[model samples]
Target: MKQGIHPDYHKVVFQDSSTGYKFMSSSTKGSDETIEWEDGNTYPLIRVEISSDSHPFYTGKQKFTQADGAVDRFNKKYGLSNN
Candidate 1:
């Protein structure tokens, strides 16, 4: 509640780098980049790797990862014959 003790809280644009999804929210984080939002106002831009739009969990999708040689090891360990 004290002045000059807290970081500046203002409108910020969080963008998903992979999907190019952008949203506006209030944040105290600072950025040198600026973006003109749909509201015709400029806001600090923050780039994020993942967001709800492209996230597998949020989108109810599963991400497939290759096990490489580990797959054979796992199968052998559990005696799971790969027929």
Candidate 2:
């Protein structure tokens, strides 16, 4: 018989302990908005924006980034005439 040692638990329960917690704001909060707890501490409210949601990695959706002179740069680097 093998005996396991007791592990120390330092868990702090907050008013909001729900996963995927969403807050109603005008705009999305990118890991911002720190709320001071009763213990005089701050913590983040939301997590990943495009995780388990509408994202390219999860939903297999490809999003194109439109940048100025992007094709011109590629053609120049490949030694192709950008005419």
Candidate 3:
């Protein structure tokens, strides 16, 4: 509700550096780089290292480590029999 107290929020294009995937979103961040979007409009270009396109979780390439139960881990650590 206050004026001149908030950061400038505007549309920007985020590019995934590794996958080269791009999408437009609004943010308070700004950059000197610019890009021409499919809509024939130019927006600030923001480069990011990872996005949903290249993320392991979204791409189903994530590796999950199987962790043993607490009791099993304790027994294994102490070299004690399960019985």
What lDDT tens digits, residue by residue, belong to model 2 across residues 37-70?
4566554444434443454665668776766578
lDDT string for model 3 (12-80, tens) is 999999999999999999999999999999999999999999999999999886566776888888999
Winner on TM-score (2 vs 3)? 3
| Candidate 3: stretches off by over 4 Å | 69-71, 79-81
For each candidate in turn, give its C-alpha RMSD to the true structure in angstroms. 5.3, 11.8, 2.0
Q: Which residue pairs come into collision in candidate 3?
A: none
| TM-score-better candidate, 1 vs 3 | 3
Candidate 2 wrongly placed segments (more than 4 Å): 1-20, 23-64
Candidate 1 residue runs with Cα over 4 Å from true position:
63-83
Predictions in order: lDDT: 0.91, 0.48, 0.95
- Cα deviation at 67, candidate 2, in Å, is 5.2
Question: What TM-score, over all chains together, does every model reach?
Answer: 0.69, 0.22, 0.86
- Maximum-TM-score candidate: 3
Displacement of residue 39 (Cα, Å) in model 1 is: 0.9
What is candidate 3's local distance difference test score? 0.95
- Report the alpha-carbon TM-score of model 2 versus the true structure: 0.22
Backbone steric clashes in candidate 3, count: 0
